[model samples]
Target: MDTIEWQDFERVELRVGTIISAEPNVKARKPAYVLQVDLGEFGVKTSSAQITAHYSAESLVGKQVLCVCNFAAKSIAGVRSEVLVTGVYDDENRVVLASFEHPLPNGSRLA
Candidate 1:
């Protein structure tokens, strides 16, 4: 694995956000959801996520997730994805979101 300096890692804008809304991204070739997350001072951001294998739109609401906030925005499945909702690929090749057990203030930086 490539090693990165602490500063390099710190430069990544990883923050916490709460899922305020979620809906199916019907335009996507693969099943996905368009999510609106509340990032406190950073404001609300949207993301197109393929996490339907393990999550439902109803189950996703109020869930706090970690996100890469600094990445450039991209249009995914007809949605303007503004942030990267971080997750890991499970054995089934489904995305399992990176989540926190404890409640955190929105926009809290991941250290």
Candidate 2:
């Protein structure tokens, strides 16, 4: 694995954001959802997450999750994904999101 200094890692804008809304991305070839996350001062950002195996549109709302906000917006599955919703793959290869059990300020940086 590539090693980096703490400052280098800190440059990545990993923040906490709450899922404001989610919907099925029908245009996607594989199953996916288009999510809108409220990032406090950063405002609402969008992402396309392939987490259908463990999540639903209804369940995602109001959930807080880690996000990488510095990446440029890109088109994914017909949606303009603005931020990366960080997650880890499970044994089944399904994505399980990195989430917080306690509420944090939106856009709170992960130190």
Candidate 3:
């Protein structure tokens, strides 16, 4: 991987957000969900996550997950994805969310 300076890393706005709501994104070719995340000061943002393999809509609500907030919005599966919900892949190639065990204020920045 290419090494980046501290400033470069700082440019990526990695923050914690709470999932306010989630639902299936029917327009996606692959199974996915449209999520509404509360980013506190950043307000609520939307994301399209391909996490249906490991999580359901009911399981995602109220979950606190990390996200990249500065990314430009893009159209995904007929929805506007405003932020990138971060996750790591499991051995089964399913996405496991990067979440917190305890509650945090919405839009908490990751240092």
Best by lDDT: 1
Question: Could you give candidate 1's per-residue lDDT for residues 47-105 as a string of tens digits?
Answer: 99999999999999999999999999999988999999999999999999999999999
Query: Candidate 3: which pairs clash?
Result: none
Question: Each candidate: what lDDT?
Answer: 0.97, 0.96, 0.96
Stretches off by above 4 angstroms in model 1 are none
Q: Which ranges of candidate 3 are over 4 A from the true structure?
A: none
Query: Residue 80, candidate 3: how far off, in angstroms?
Result: 0.6
| Model 2 misplaced stretches (Cα beyond 4 Å) | none
lDDT of 2 by residue, 4-74 (tens): 99889988999999999999999999999999999999999999999899998999999999999999899
Question: Residue 98 lDDT in model 1?
Answer: 100
Q: Give the top-scoring candidate (TM-score).
A: 1
Candidate 2 has what TM-score?
0.97
Give TM per candidate: 0.98, 0.97, 0.97
Q: Candidate 2 at 106: error in angstroms?
A: 0.4
Q: How many residue pairs clash in each candidate?
A: 0, 0, 0
Kindly report the root-mean-square deviation of model 3 from the true structure over all alpha carbons: 0.7
